[model samples]
Target: MIDKILNTRTILAVDDDPTNIHAVAGYLQPHGAKLLVANSGEKALEVLAQNIPDLIILDINMPGQSGIEVCRKIKQDTRLEQVPVLFLTGSVKDVSEAFAVGGVDYIVKPVRSEELLARVSTHIRLSQLVKSLDKANLLLESVNESLEMKVQERTLELVTVNKNLRIEIDERRRLQDKISYLSNYDFVTRMFNRNSMEQELKVVMETQSDADARSFLYYIDLDQFKIINDTCGHVAGDELLRQIAELLRGGFEFASICARMGGDEFAVLSQSLNLDDAIKRAHLIKDNIENHRFEWNEEVFKHSISMAVVEIDEGIDSVSHLLSIAERTCFESKRKGGGEVSIYNYSKDYIDKTQQQMKIIPLIHQAIEDNQFILYFQHICANNDSKLQKIEVLLRLQDESGKIKPPGHFIPVAERFHLITEIDKWVLKNTFKAISSLPENIIVSINLSGEFIIKSNAVELIRDLLLQHKVQPSRICFEITETSAISNIGATHRFMLELNETGCLFSLDDFGTGTSSYEYLKQLPVDFVKIDGMFVRDIENDEISRKMVESISGIARAKQIKVIAECVESEAALNIINNMGVDYYQGFVAHKPEPLMNLFTLVK
Candidate 1:
């Protein structure tokens, strides 16, 4: 710092007399300024070449090159021109010439010590202030540039947020439309309702005017649906209906129309089928239904369906007539012990739910390959103390058209297809890439899939990733679902132990949702228990949920595990959780999940 301050105001003194230069140097060097002395103007230029002093002192009358000529040369060289020049001479007559040649001030020969020192001090201080002002200007420009960049980033974030909100609103509208549309069909089976089928049949019969215009109708009834429902309850029966609907949807041709006409009864319309094709479809549907097995509650149930086919010729003028004929034919098959596919003269056959779950499967693979996945972070902080802040990483997908999709759309499908492990790895890799830019005091927590933890070499992968990213393991926390961890306790326990050795912390997410949460909490090496939203969201209103949160918080506190309350959407919920000794609160009220690109602004 001394050198810096000293370097800021270096003064070069030039004269033919050593005594004169020595006197000048002696006066200025003691006043916290560096001094350079030259006995001639030629040597002064050499000194100037080596060090561009902030202030230059010149003698007007020199041997080789006069001070006027040297001052002319200094002014000609733009690099040296800015250094303030003070001239020393015997005559006051040279003062106008000195000023003309760019000399800023003059000190006469036989200089007084105080006058020379005072002038030198004045010029050097002014030069230093100018230099400081220039530096300040540059610094201000840099700060403005940084501010512009931050504003642009913030604008982009707001645009992204707005885009996501629009997508969400659009999704809700689409879901509502689907719900309203589904109302015309069976919700459990996702098949057309009896009214929809009858209306569709009416249209077909009325639209096709040819006397021989034909369609095939099939009536389907599950043979053992009642027995299964009675034995396994309605939940299992509903699941059975869904599975059968999928089979029927897949087994028939694309042109065929199928519906769940009523309980345990279904209908299919083949608008362009002859006796042979209709019979062939009936046999196929019959075989597929009998072979399919529905598993529920660890027990497997196999059931067969009876189907009857009726031909819709011009002879069938009414939708009711077609349905009645199909029903009677189906009853004949039911009388044959319910496994046969019966057919009326020139007859049809078949049977179909969550349409979105199927749609998301392809999107999951597309997203992973296209690098559409992105990271979002929600801040978790102490309720009373804002200093204690952390971020929980959340995953989102941006599709080809630039729509941001929340994880809820695709995560279930990914889990179903066992593609969640790959997605988890993608998240971990990207997260490590991002975390190094965060502030040292802010810790980041990433979620680990239970399946990935147990099935993959997750500990080794995470250790390698942390090392590769040059991130401290202590800065990261892994969140695990309580029920998932319990499902594969042995493997999950080992994974936690090995990773915990590397200083990674753990949080049991959705804490109170699982059975035996307290039992498993004792065994798992978790540092936090994130209270489930179900309990926290209504804690202020519902006594049972409030007690559940209290019990979980109490148990967690007893075990030395800090508790975090999630989905804290209101100040009341935050206050309630805070009063219960919960260590942290996270939800929309506190912070929304934002893209990690803005993490620098968030860092402490």
Candidate 2:
């Protein structure tokens, strides 16, 4: 039943018995299903609160809350009511109660593998079909209501068409003309469409006689167009785009062609003599749009645009290639804080940097395979008595030539290829093993990449390593950045919850940098909040930075999360943050990162 079309499914197994959970996982995982397990009904609810598993294999008779009670609670929740629940009960007596409590089906204990999978697949497919039909019914009802209202109007039109031949001919001609117009023009802006613009550009390139003759393709993309569409409605968004289209038409009269490429993107092919002329025209177009404002629902929006000019010369390849360069240039403009113009130069360092980064991807693979990644440790000092409470794990890549490389060079490249998960795992396994020889009081903190938390195997990998190293989970700390948690809150929540079971501490690393929402302290089971170094370093003078530190400390204190200020370079800054309620500090003012062998000196 798990076919190509259905893809992978997620199943949550709730049972106190380890054997039952194992059976459920064995049957499901092989068939491309993700398995989540909880030993109790309350723990199951905690999992369900964040994650919606496709099929739930619930146990009926448990110590505290039975499967029926769990099903009843799940059905009571509006978000989970639609989810199908399957009960695994020992007694036939529990079958009827299971159904009464909203169980889709039931499988008696001593489950046959084939039968369990069959029942699970059947309920999942049926649930999907039911949801699909419900959605289709709503759409079909709306369509039928509109068709019923149009029935009389259509009947009258048919009769009129039979009576009057001239009117019918005129209607047909009007429809044909409209179709012809639409084929070459945009429906929203009434400008040349992408297809027509390609033909026009081809014609221009073929007709050029002089060897020195050149044109510039100005590709423009509206900045923050989604914000306008979201704040205002799509209708208002379209109106603003149409207005921008009009402004472009009026502003760039000398331009050979003005076209609407697609959503929030426009283009103009200019036959200007030099790059300066093209740049000036691009600036004028940008200025014109900036000067104008569109109002909707009493809200005014000043839309800005990012545009790029690519020179079309004899060296240019084709229409597609030219367009690609133009698009890339425009993206660069947007990336540099939009509302600006960029000229594509093959000599620019961005292309070179990209090429260099591409080379590192393989290096990352080799490093992981060969164990070239090395570790360093920095002490997180308890400010009150200048005692080091823990050490933050730092990663470094040793190149083939035997020189140590900082994480800055290779970490970003690793993250770009989604290899940071493996790197984090490497860190955990090695960190746990290394710390095995250290004293238990020396808590070792490992920084987890955003990529690691979202992976399903993160918890399993950590658990196996912890067991292999025979390390106490309480002495191992996993540091997750605020940016990582906010990216996929549900996956992060589940990962943290599962990992928390091992008794490891969590620190919301780089605190003041992300969403800056203090609610994370409550949502995440974080034992510590490590304030971003940028804020901590400037807290001595900057009022806003000081306020941020104070607010974080005040709220985090209320939540009982200890605050650790990073990059505390000055005693003045440390004093300020210490007074502001920061429990721990990490910077040059206290302790610097050193080789793992020197970790013992941190606590000393």
Candidate 3:
């Protein structure tokens, strides 16, 4: 840092004495200082015009101009004012005048080399320090101004970037919130959807045991909903549903989860309520809906709802099972009439009520042990003669109070628990014995469960029974529903083939109700195809139903197989079937189901 400031400095030696100039030049020449010799004041001024030196050594006894005059002239110019001057004097006579004109110090006599170099070096270093300080002050002011400008420009850019960043954060938060709402909430009713409700129930089931407070599920359906939609329009129907959703939301406390289960159906999962309280809540909702009047397009209409409440307890295996009970119970309410509330019952509290599968399992075991099972026979009459063609033996169970329950009441439980095969064995044994003495032309049909057909040694069992009772195999027809047969088609075909070799007949019951579209008939050895009752029951009034029945009958005839129309409850239905070329009919219109013993007397 020091070498840059005080490096290779020049010194001006102004003197009229030639010898003095030579001595001064020779003294500084050996050192690193550049020496300029000026013989007079005028000469020094000429030298100063072309170049500026670091320091000046002026002899007081000069010839042309006095040393003091020369120093004064040098100090007059502003550019040369800061240069340090050292006087070469014969005495201390003119040194004061030299100091007055910016003379820093003076040397006497010939100017010894040691004294001359020391004074020249000191003044050069001092002069350099002053010039560097002045340059720095000027540069500092310029840099400060530039720094202020940069800070202003950069600060503005940062503000803009920060604003945009905040906007992006807010937009992302809004998008995330919208996605969350759509996932968990139904857009139509602004309530929890089925997915959220199922998850909540699953959490409760998985995390808890039998809760001290009983939870209940209410399954609700609007009564005669189609009437409103057809007469008023779907717009009016949607508005009515919205109003009812709000009503349901307000009726229950915040504890319950209310949801719309699509269309005109809704459900509520109560947090905790006993059976009585749950029933009352369901009735309250039913009454509220029944009394609420909806005004649309200046026309006012009233509506009612049917509801079913099932307690959500540990007895239920899963959410689907609990919902199944609720659906059946609600359907039972509609079956009787709308504008009613029904509670799911376990035992004989309901003579023909919705039964829980778990509660009925033990009852089925008990029934099997105590011989509480019975057989009821419904007559299947031939079409052209309208005479008795056969009798279908229906399985029934007697409860503790002797009320007969149909297959719909307990068959699902029996099938699920693998007890259906046992029930089938009982039916086959009793049926074979009851008709042992009957005429050979009287064919008796017995329904077999899919589980029994797929897993049991059915062909050998039936063969043994046929030989034991001496009842002709041709008179005994085994009935398997289309849905059950489709589940195990190969097994069903094998069982039928083995039994067919023995002269026993196979009939596919409930045809046209499964996933198969008449393609399975050619695959199996079926003697008769019973058109599903769903189509036959509505054939008198519905064209679609009539078309379905007609097509099925045509296909059966094409295969050279007879078609049986089930659920022919009215003469209208029978007349329709007769026109369609149906061979036989089985329904209450022909004859109500009679006991197996009673049927024996009729045939005898």
Candidate 4:
């Protein structure tokens, strides 16, 4: 008698031999279980295709396909590999061989009913244990989610109460005829609360009516305030904000209103000022913010500030619109860097262009869904002979109206919205597709934004593209700006090496511009250097500019890397660079970046 009482469990029995299958099925049938039979390995696979069972009883030495082959196939499949396999073999040798192919256990037949039932029951019980573990893991995740939601609810209640207390304090000060001296002002250094400042701006805009009189609103945000907050704690963050507020108020005393807009942001409203005067005040405020040193617990901390100034004119229709324009202008300033100020001018095309871009963002998103963007290749040539060594794939957006818009008009907007990643993916797919049609040994390079490089999965997307296209990785190159490479060295280095491992190359573009370090040139995984257009444009006439290019070209040669002189227009600039041993060149003299169709005609 079997020691264990059999519980009902479904079992799938697979074999080509009908007598052997019947014998195994009959043994399991009496043990309070249902048996499913498949006549061959192919039929067993088909059974699994439709439904999964708790355990499989397989027979070895069947026709059409061996049990070992079926067992191996089952183990190889990710979905079926977890199901326990019990082999039905005629001999001990066959059972040993079956175990080699990932079978769990075996029963030798002409079968003893008791032994077969015992082994089947044990394997089924093991499979049940695994399913139980999975359910427990799911339950643990649900409990964690419930606890997180409760914590978030408590946090919101605290913030709401804090805001109410602040409003009451402001009201009490107003009753005491110390409305401007309210507790909303940080007494330690005299900066207003974010809530108070916003309220003040609303009052000023409502009270003033002269449209021609320019009212300047400056939004100031300190750079890297979080670093000080983390390093020196909330006390230090509070102290820094207080000190910054004092410096701003002192510097802009002539302004109509100076108020702290919470955290590290401050707002200044200057009334009845000309464009030049407003700009002068904006610069002075910026300089003061940069020069001011904050002392926290006896340690001096220095940081920069970014400012966005908007001059209220007749065109400004609403107070919200005025504030929104200032905020967006400030955002643009922050993107460029935090040490300067950007004044919102009504005449600037970027503002209207940005508004139009916002309107088209939804349309652009739809284009991505409908596969409307197309990739075009513009060749980057050898400057000396004008021979094409590589092509740079450029993206063009085709709208519903069948209009092709150049990247220059839309790429900046794409970068601003962080939508460049999707555009980058589309470029990689279409570029690789284009490569298959091009001649072998010709390299294709793609230009990527610093934002895309720093924030997205550029490497993974490119790797998948190369694999799908079956293109040689060596034929692909990625170009990044010199400024971007130096900005985040660690992240850029990791990305470069990851792609380099797959035989792709990297180029440090627009070299000799910005605050790029020459020391970084040797440290970076750079293959080609593209000289900035500024140097090339003036090199023909300016001795100083020509000398700079010569020096940069010499450095590139010493490192055994190629250099491409960009924007070379005149014969003299070309003659100078070729003599300096520049590896390649690009300019109007060689070729301008044209449409891919034009490039085909020009090259032919």
Q: lDDT of each prediction vs. the true structure?
A: 0.78, 0.79, 0.78, 0.72
TM-score of each: 0.45, 0.50, 0.43, 0.52
lDDT of 3: 0.78
Q: At residue 140, what lDDT does model 4 achieve? A: 45
Error of 1 at 541 (Å): 1.3
lDDT of 2 at 59: 94
Minimum summed lDDT over a 10-residue window in model 1 is located at 346-355
* lDDT (10s digit) by residue, model 3, range 385-417: 643358899888999998999888888877754
Candidate 4 per-residue lDDT, tens place, 493-537, comes to 888898899999888888998565578788888898888888889
TM-score of 1: 0.45
Question: Whose TM-score is higher: candidate 2's or candidate 4's?
Answer: 4
Task: Pick the winner on TM-score between candidates 3 and 4.
Answer: 4
Q: 414-491 in candidate 1: lDDT tens per residue?
A: 785456887998899999988887776778989988878975457788999999999988889999998889889999
lDDT of 3 at 12: 90
Best by lDDT: 2
Give the C-alpha miss distance for residue 588 in model 2, angstroms.
0.9
lDDT score at residue 42, model 4, on the 0-100 scale: 91
